[model samples]
Target: MTEFRAFHNTDPPQLLKLWHAAGLGRGAAECLSIDAFEVLIFSQPYFDPNGLIVAVEDGEAVGFVLAGFGPNEEESALDYSIGIICAVIVHPNFRRRGIGRELVLRAEEYLKSKGAMNITAGPSGLLSPYLVGLYGGTRPSGFLLSDPLAAPFFESIGYDATRSIRIYQRDLLGPKPPIKFHLVNLRRKMQLMISDDYQAPNWWWLTRLGRLETLHFELVPKTGEGAVASATVIGLDLYIPKWEERVIGLTDVFVKENERSKGYGQSLLLEIARRLQDELITKLEWHVEESNTVASHVALAVGYYQIDTGIVYQLVSR
Candidate 1:
């Protein structure tokens, strides 16, 4: 017999055990420690004990679901209008017994009770409240297609795929990437600045990326006072134990509004790649929404190739 209950203080070890047994996918961190969960999940200021539902069988944990909400429009507070099911994992031996469905159903009820007008499965961009570095490669990029169980499991539970995010990767050891003439000229007039301990500009950014080992890069005019473009890369150290390769994931890429189409974005990306290659990092990944053609073009211009797709889902009747 199995029973469901809210998360308890002593449940991290059990949840970590279930995480290993569930086969979350390549994007998921392997060999995770309790400390990682402490920093990435439990320590978040917005963590709600009731939002994380766990399943117990014979007093052993078998599955869990983590649900939360994104920031409000002002990016200053939680927005209960859009609730997110950030993660759902079930132990392999305990699956096929409706445990996953029950967990999701309970998660839905919890979200609705909290005033959610919309419910989305898997976290992405501003919709993400946690699991930024634990699950997704770069940032929370919805449920990755590489996870064989995600699509079928969510669809069977009445969710429909409503958006797709393309995961792109570039080999740092490969031949030189294509460089446009405008980018070359842009580089001459701009200086590339790199920092390993840069500060977040706002509360929202600090909440999402504050705990990770991030590499920040910016492109600024040689004589200007501010950056025209910037990009952030996070060390995927958890992956190193499993993949045995030095890897970093790109996220929070930005270009000033007035700087768009001036080639600063591509220039900053190429410079970042060059610097990482020199540091012997083997791979870099960037996730872009399918609708963002401009970002896709920038990524492709830097020799990135599509490696996978992440799907974001919602209830059919919602």
Candidate 2:
């Protein structure tokens, strides 16, 4: 018989095992450890013990659900009144026993108790409190889309894919096609500058966890035209299960609204790539969201082809 109970801090080892079995906690040789979990997730301001509902069978943990809400001030931005189901994983050995569904049901109830009128399965849209840490990004593929079990499982519970994102992977293991950019001209005209160890505009949750070393580039105006564009390469890939040498995830390039269309964003991207290539980073990945047409175009131009697409599922409370 399977027993359901609230998760405790001591359950990290079991949960980490479950994450590995479920094909999660990637980018590492080992799954999240107790200390890692505390730094990556439990340290969040919105983390609630009740949010982690686990299932135990014969004293061995089998499955669990993690849910949470955004900060009060950011409710409007994230549909805070509507809770988020960050993750739901069941061990493969214990599959097809309704364990997954039960975990979600309990997660919804926990969110309802928090005054949520509706619930979203994951990052359906915008920045969310879901899938942080090793899976961190303002917008990433939904946890469900990455897992074969997640799609059908969520549908069975009335959750549907409200949004889908295209995940592009580039093979840096081979020689990269050379690309041209007017970087020198831009630097003189727009005062574009590149600096080491760049950080992005702070987001509360991001500041607390999951930040890796990255490069920062920005446009400083010479004519006092104000900021033109700013981008940062955030986070490293293949850090877990051992580290991938000379590689990093290419993310978060922002060109000011008025400054867009001059190829600033793309210029920044290629420049970052060139800098990395010089340092022997042969593998680079550029992730593009469905709505980010500019970045999407850049990904393709830079020889990145479609490898995987991720969908964000949502369930409105009934």
Candidate 3:
């Protein structure tokens, strides 16, 4: 017999045991440290304990799932919700059971109760369909992909795959040819437009991070024209406190279609490195669509290496 319950602070040790037994130690090690998981549960904008479910068999936790609920910035009427099956480990001795599915169902129930019209899992990048349906926006936290079996498991149960993204990292201390482009210094001008009362779906995250003194921005001039054609926003995220103690994170960088091949993206990245280097930052990270060849080339030329892959999955109530 199997039963599911909410995850508690005291479940880490048991959870870790299940994680270790499932041959997922490396993946588990990266995201589920005792301290980090605790912080994730408490630090997120909407973290309901009732949304985190654990599957138990014979009084021991065999699987776990986590879900969060919040308002969708683009679709104010539809509450935004995310359900992550963070750990769905079934003891090697107890494989082929329906415990994982039950845990997922419980998580979905919790999210629905919070007024969520859709639920997505895996990586935020793969959740675009859900985001587009729920928020009418494409912004995702990151990209991730589930295992083949996992993908089918979700699909068989109603989840669909959308897009996948790869996480890339660029080492800042490497020797590279100087990037040449006309730089339009817009820090002072841009700062003037920022305010504590301004709110927008796309800019809300930026505004919140701006309040922390970690947000930075640069505007690039359009090629063949003096007008601004692109903008880049960078910030610092303390997600992985150990591996990336103070890494520079690329918040957003957009180049107009007409601005292609003008080196605007390259210039923006170089300037970001130069500015952050002045402050002693040594690492920079960003996410790129796996299908975007242009962006991939730019990233590679700038010494960035593909490190991790993630997907964002989305679902909307029909």
Per-residue lDDT tens digits for candidate 1, residues 161-248, read 9999999999888877765788888888989888887987767778878888897898888997799999889988888876689889
Q: In candidate 1, what residue range of length 10 has the lowest lDDT sum?
A: 174-183
* Model 2: ten consecutive residues of lowest lDDT: 24-33
Over the stretch 179-296, how does candidate 3's per-residue lDDT look in tens digits?
4434234322221111234233453343233233334354423333342333333434323432554456664566667766866666567666666777767777777887888888
Order of candidate numbers by TM-score, starting with the best: 1, 2, 3
Residue 291, candidate 1: alpha-carbon lDDT: 99
lDDT of 2 by residue, 8-90 (tens): 87888888788777765332224346666666667766677898999999888899998876544543233457688878889
Cα error of candidate 2 at position 76, Å: 11
TM-scores of all candidate predictions against the true structure: 0.96, 0.84, 0.64
Pick the winner on lDDT between candidates 1 and 2: 1
Local distance difference test, candidate 1: 0.89
On lDDT, the leading prediction is: 1
Cα deviation in Å at residue 257, candidate 2? 1.2
Off by over 4 Å in 3: 12-33, 43-45, 74-95, 113-117, 125-158, 173-215, 219-247, 254-262, 275-282, 291-294, 314-318
Number of the top TM-score candidate: 1
In the predicted model 2, the residue pairs found to clash are 27-240, 28-240, 28-241, 29-240, 29-241
- Show where candidate 2 strays beyond 4 Å: 25-31, 71-79, 124-126, 136-139, 144-146, 173-205, 208-211, 220-226, 237-246
- The lDDT values for all models are 0.89, 0.66, 0.53
